[model samples]
Target chain A: MSKTLAIGPFNDAERAALSDEFSPVFLAKPDELAGLTDDQRAAATAVAYKGHHAFGAAQMDLLPNVGIVANFGVGYDAIDVHAAAARSIKVTNTPDVLNDDVADLAVAMLLMQCREMEQASAWARSGNWKSKGEYRLNRKASGGTVGIVGLGRIGREIADRLAAFKMDIHYFARSEKTTPGWQYHGDPVSLARAVDFLVIALVGGKDTENFVSAEVIEALGPRGVVVNISRGSTVDEAALLDALENGKIAGAGLDVFLNEPAIDDRFYKLDNVVIQPHQGSGTVETRAAMAKLQRDNIAAHHAGKALLTPVN
Target chain B: MSKTLAIGPFNDAERAALSDEFSPVFLAKPDELAGLTDDQRAAATAVAYKGHHAFGAAQMDLLPNVGIVANFGVGYDAIDVHAAAARSIKVTNTPDVLNDDVADLAVAMLLMQCREMEQASAWARSGNWKSKGEYRLNRKASGGTVGIVGLGRIGREIADRLAAFKMDIHYFARSEKTTPGWQYHGDPVSLARAVDFLVIALVGGKDTENFVSAEVIEALGPRGVVVNISRGSTVDEAALLDALENGKIAGAGLDVFLNEPAIDDRFYKLDNVVIQPHQGSGTVETRAAMAKLQRDNIAAHHAGKALLTPVN
Candidate 1:
């Protein structure tokens, strides 16, 4: 009888690692938890969770003895912490470890858009450069003003990298941060207006839904580019599409989208946009670290020890 | 009769700028110099050259009165500086102005390859991310060691940017430079062995035709990534392709290729390569700066003043 259920699609190596410590029952999705036999369900003392699926009270009820949910990712928006706390269930998340990878991707996406690297790379591969003369001139990325939509850990990481490129950094958070020479904006609209590139690094969920509104998109103007590495809910997709279509704004380099993998098909046809499948922390080193942290949390829970990074 | 022959396909703005100082005769190529009327040839005191066409003594002879060849780009390998100096023809090139743009592209290409962003972006756009669970895991780029070939001005710029990402900097130059904390290797193979990324920033021409040889490529090994923002001839393309095809070297992010536009078609089919069409300095702001520098040299030559950025 297993004391743990490792939910979500783990790669072969990750699954092997989990099996070493727990007599784990693997479930790729939370919906599958209800389908487990009573014996399997009753035996579970903890859940090592992954994926961006909602894990609420209904799922919690299915595994009554599952005292803790150890999430693989830093963000726990998918897991309802309040619901977990209500059921006397503890929730823990992996944080800080994946910050560099996420921050690296945000800046990479921004550079891709600013320099039009996608088109240039494609042109070279297709043997177009020889026949077509030279790749078209792109805008310079460095030495420009950049606006970050949040100043949390991930946002600060991004700002630090861009600063090395000689960029002037401006950011918006609930309140001001104490970083030297970094300008703080009270609202996102003004931040967008003052900078050439706007990067969104806000936390996911309801409060940040459409945080980058149509007015903010409009304020970004023709020379503006938006780079989003956070959840898709942070930006208004409709307004962003309109701005890109009409050339109201220059371009965007997006990692996450609303209903991703099933993202807006219009993004496919746009040359101005560089769309990446939400892969901020998809690097092998980072993923391995995330998986290890998640396993460590579950190990702690099973031992009746304090969780390494508890959420609720 | 023109006092200057703008010997490349100049844009409307660039041509207008040239006309401000000289009786500009616009030629899209250097070969067209042979077709010029005697009076037009005799009137030309300076040539504002662009493109990668060989402007040897043969081309120089077409304009007997030409005193200066003011090349648009920093690299004057095509201009044959020794040939120009032999004919008592002064050579000047636009340098330093394009350094930041090239450095930015080099780092961007490295990030794109490390994250496998091209395929990931395509998957998101193709609606595969929705159907498929997630993008494949890729290697981490930040906090790794990077080796620079020929740590000149542009190499220094690339090193500075990568350092901000917490990357360890290593380089090979004729003589070790005085950069603090950056390790200098006396040999190319040692440099390649020491770092995950090998960036080529060597000056072009016969002396550097195959500076990154098969030995260095082999030394880089399977985990190594090669980023070339220098001239294509700087690397042994055949050895590079073989390594990439055999999985001997992990991948390449190349901005330059031998016979570019007509480069090896094998590169097109390779998923492990990021082929950029030699657009290192192909940014609007940088190109404008380069054009200004080229014009400044031309202006200096006509005024019997010393050249602004003289090569000989």
Candidate 2:
């Protein structure tokens, strides 16, 4: 077996662990792979991948012996699975490990938004509560209607947590699920129309690009809050921003966004929105689990065993 | 029958509803009662009270015919229940109605604190995610050990919601109840020692003041978070602030403080602490429910019926 290439800027501990197991060559970016000598390229048979940097055929071609790409996150959108499959290369992603963290974040954002906790916290943090009297009463989050855009694993987890708060769970999926007491709407618009919160948990790909459209956003109306823990591509960012700017919708709690790290400047100006740095799975415990799963798949590939969570 | 007095700064709708049913004399402060004529004071048979100002026997004596003191909130520590009982005055408080909102806030605050949502939100808002890399990984909130200081109505609600997240629930109450699967500790220190999060849901009063003392705070150890949604008096605020400041404990999610609105300024300096303006039940729906319940109790007192949620 050839040596492994560890890509992306992992923490010191993760990097040390990767080096200890695989005796890997480290590269922060895929583009740097081209700079490696022919011997180094030939030695790279597997890659431990992290970050949102695109890993396509070009990068794979640089490592001629690369047989497997193990991604650190549940979503492998940045990795070209089709390209990997065509090159007889295996692809594996760490899933299920991050479901709890993402689900917790989704629930936290929804409750924080609906309850106006951000402002309430700020009011208390400042001396305003003493001078301004009690914080203004906001909406009750519990026992309200919540419509999930997709009822996949992560979505199901989100719904499960929300259900504990006595919320009415509505979901939009291609096929109805067997979850009792949960309402299933045929389309996104109908789902949006039926709920006070629209939480997006759809998988990321070309097919899901702008899955939550203008019509769906409009259907959610003024009382609705849009919470997105899935890819920003799943939502029509322009439409969502316009609605929020004009008071067409109540607010949003967004983690992922289009062109993130440099998301739309307008979002910062809106007090109704709560912005998170695409950190749904950015927890020490969850990241450790994801890293472990990624390493396990890489170890399996090296051992000539079946991949634990293969995508391609 | 004498008239009912609607005291405190009520919203227009609440005032209108109170006036529509009972001939209510509105007073923004208890001191304002002295301005009323002797006949006006004599005509007051019931009081719909709000605000944190002390309502002792002195204020109660102002209304010689006052039959019932209906408090708008669950905690009636501000009202002298002993004085009410001594004067044969019926006292009622609105409980259970606000449990859902308060519990929702407790969960929200805990998740928010453990997730480092305050810094995460600021990073995204300031466009730092683009300038900087991924936000540093924070602690996982779900599936962690949580110790409840009191297993009262609100504490039980908090525990119930946390159970949905698959947390290990341990509780400190006077006596262990018949709750299956949840571990019960006889004391606060032992409970704090075993859990990653210490959530205070004990009732506020002299008996429970500083219920979570320095010893309990120390027992929680590092990596432990303290979430208080009950009242300011339940926990030793000085000890909590010291623990947070000195990094003795991890963090805290406080909805109540020792002197809220004017709480210890030291708390404002800590990045790990999440503060709220005593907004455990400050939701429009829950507050409306509480107000309605208060009115109902006052109405019951006038009709010679039993008080709905009598405290004295």
Candidate 3:
């Protein structure tokens, strides 16, 4: 008998493409698994989510024969990897494919904040057109300092984009990287002091929890701008608020927050900051490419080919 | 027996520099001529205004010995050249020194508007950070069409900058000239249809009055952006307002306006536009350079040498 794979928050194209090779069963609802017989459920091998929160390991428990949970994004934090590991079900995440797109946003945020483009636009709209005098011209990105907190794939790509602007690049990494044109610092504090724009690209975990605190923010000085593209847990939310309120740091461009969808109201009132919802890899072109990579990874794993991006 | 020069509205540094060369009579007000005796006023050889709105030629005739009106900036439209010519007074303007600075602003405005950096920042600050998830990714400037109106010194410099972005460049001029890397269009309407970004670099005058009308704007289509660094008279305000309101054109970035220091309030409400208070060459570094060039032009004329930028 052929193995059955449960699929979907239902991407029609991904489902059709997968059905060409496997006997695919479309799971429309979480409760529908209760109706499946033991033997039928045991025949399922792989599962994918069409919706944001559908593809967790607990959902995989409905299918006894499930071997892999391939996620459609670089972030698989929502997936309980430990639960899958206990069940001997492999979890795969799409990475590196979305690096350029996220890096483009990071640089865009930095430029927007430093240049004060938002405030300038507001001033233009306010009937102060004739009275609107010259704006405060900040230092250009070209030949300026740019510091990165993490030296991972995305962080490195951000460095490469800033390099095109002729910026001096620096990074804080656990170990020294021999990349040309990048100065590696021992810690985040040291990195903040050395640069005018500090970008946070570190992974979220116990070691990186609250890595950017009041001390590090203070070290960035009054004219520095902080851009966080990583998880909100890596930064001290209260300290950032205090620093921003007191003008300890010049401004910030945040893509992630401590309590997303319930962000602090103070960040909204400040004209100096730039904020975006966690859209690091949210571009249509980049997301589609990521989904395809995830699909290919599952197919390659089942065929016993070398996995594209293996975590464990 | 030394000739005097009336210096109006110059900064301290410019005044000090002029004091070294001539017997400088600082004109505190337009009516300050009343302070001078007939012989003292008659000894004046030249008059200068740092900013626009210098007195008319009627005031210049008060000083019968005056030979030139050396303006600080490139634009002398406020100065009545016909009246100066009637009294046989040569007029000189400082140009070429401000081309690169103004061109830099024009490009920066274009990039900021297309990227929607202002709107993104506002959304972030409005406590709707999650809405940023829906931001439309910007089209790359590389391999895009750039249209230049008034192919002069600054327009050419804008073309030079666009070369780095890998844009296909075209221009609309009164007469065609053989310039490599630029295809010349016969008129503004044709240029509007040919490019994604239409940049206004034409001078403001009767010859070029309302050069960008409703017809030209209508031809630009919905995805087009207008970047104006030239005088406001080059564009019809009513046509621009109509296009912006109806979404016929995507957006605009304007530095000069029809009635400057008295801008319309409607421009303030649009998220698609960027407005500056006529600060094209307002940078401290660039302004200092401009002042030095103006002084050099005056000294060159005084020495009976060729004027640096004589009004033809």
Candidate 4:
């Protein structure tokens, strides 16, 4: 039987599932991969990777016999595809299955920001609604114009949901794709300038770093709300923080931050923003699907089947 | 001027608009209606009413000379429309203008409850995301079955939005509406049993008081989530709370309660519930439109034309 070396920080169910088939060595973190013995590293034919830590050439070179890196998430920015391709190690990601969940979070965050739902919930839960009269009126979210920063599968899903809310949709992508009645922008700044809501759904990587630049944030102006469900590296975080602090834009709804978990402390104090812990694909059902997909890719690679959902 | 006597708690914008069109007396609450001089009461031909305090026959009798009561909101459950009808005094409510806003709120609340967005936002904002590994995964909101309690305009709007989320739509109304492919239940209990999420959008009045009974909550089962954006009287609050406490139902997202502002203290402690002050139509844009419609009704009534949205 071939060994499956699984990476750290999987949930109980995920661990059980991974253990049931091709029981593998588990490393606590990417840093711990170096501590493995020669026999242990050679025994493992496949690697099941998770988390946001960078897995570059240095890390890939450690597992000489490792045939594939099955990433548990759709965003494989943390994985160096160039390094994997150079070493002939196949890289596969779980996508499409998580699109609905991610899109759902994007819409939910945007509504939370526009409707001031978190504050309203707090007000009611704290017995202030009785003492403070009615919750103060908030900005209306429906029937407003929205700009989608990407036109990928997840972005299209988000645009579809917002469309049902009677929102005018505008989008920016690598090239214009024919979508009915939705306005297409040649660039992010123009899209930001045109819509009241700017939602980032761009993919992560080097070419896309700081895709939503300071100029884009400035163009979003006072009434604009920024909702980023894409990678943190895709946007200029310093610019976003500055814009939020000065009310350069109305507020923001953010899931991904430049630094995972240990994000900028400035975000903790702002009342205007709504933050989530990159839980876009964090639902029991979706996570199970993602886990299964990651495992299936590993299973297929061992069977000499073509890699499923391969990025490189 | 026909002397439009405007009643309590109007925002500055509403007050200004009312004053410009009909410069009449402005009383702070229903209790102050008795403080008016006989001449002042007689001079008032139309009353621009606001707030939730009951406008019974007694309050109506205080201003006997008033010909019409133009309510500021869609729900006239606070007003005794039957009494007005018996007295031959016209009653009108601002309706359709607020449907979009109320529908938007309903969807926002449902998504908030399903996604555990309030807790997730708190986790990220409080630096718990850094301290902890990640926000715990929650239930998915999309692709679930939903039951709309009333298939009125607002209910239809909410169902439409949820449909785009790939939700299976089921509803209960006075009679089956000619909707495409949506399952219509003859009663609330049946609707509750058939869906994962049940949303209350019924009109507030004697007819709908305690419509979402204990039986209905029980029928929804442990996997169920209730979302109420209708009147406080529409659902049995004690029953709903009991279900939430005992885990008879999964959770709830409520905007209205039996005693709002001073809602039940138990709600403040519950982790599964999401509460909001009764702000179904509370938006700067929608409120302005509602105020304008209310004024328009009064304006039309004084001009001896048909009331725009008459309840009596």
Q: Order the numbered candidates by TM-score, best leading.
A: 4, 2, 1, 3
DockQ of each model vs. true complex: 0.81, 0.87, 0.25, 0.85
**Residue-level lDDT tens digits of model 4 in A43-128:** 78899999888898998888898889999999999899999999999999999999999999999889888889888877776667
Q: Candidate 3, residues B49-150: lDDT per residue as tens digits?
A: 565554567677787887777877777776778888888877788787777667766777876676565665555555555553345544443346989998
lDDT of 4: 0.90
Restricting to chain A, the TM-score for each candidate equals 0.98, 0.98, 0.84, 0.98
Residues forming the 10-long window of minimal summed lDDT in candidate 2 chain A: A1-10
Comparing 1 and 4 on lDDT, the stronger one: 1
lDDT tens string, model 1, B54-78?
8998999888988999998989999
Model 3 lDDT per residue over A1-312, tens place: 346454444455556666776656666655576677787778767665443443555676777787777766675665677778888878777888777656766776776676565565555555454454445544344456989999998888878766655579999999999798589999889999999999998876456889998889999999889999887878998999888989999999888787675678888777778887666766545666776887777787678787676554
Native-referenced Cα lDDT, model 2: 0.91
For A168-191, candidate 1 gives per-residue lDDT tens digits of 999999999999789999999999
Task: Work out the TM-score per prediction.
Answer: 0.97, 0.98, 0.72, 0.98
**Docking level for model 2:** high
Looking at model 4, the pairs that clash are A129-B261, A130-B261, A130-B262
**Clashes in model 3: which pairs?**
A9-A50, A125-B268, A126-B268, A130-B261, A130-B262, A130-B263, A268-B125
Clashing pairs in 2: none
Candidate 4: Cα lDDT at A312: 85
Each model's lDDT comes to 0.91, 0.91, 0.74, 0.90
Model 2: per-residue Cα lDDT over A1-312, one tens digit each: 348989898898788788778878888988888888999899888999988889998998887788999998999999999999999999999999999999999999998998889999888777788788788999899999999999999999999999989999999999999997799999999999999899999999888999999999999999999999999999999999999999999999999998878888999999899888999999988988988899999999999999999987
Clashes of each: 2, 0, 7, 3
- Pick out the ten consecutive residues of candidate 4 chain A with the lowest summed lDDT: A123-132
DockQ ranking from best candidate downward = 2, 4, 1, 3
True contacts kept of each: 0.88, 0.92, 0.27, 0.90
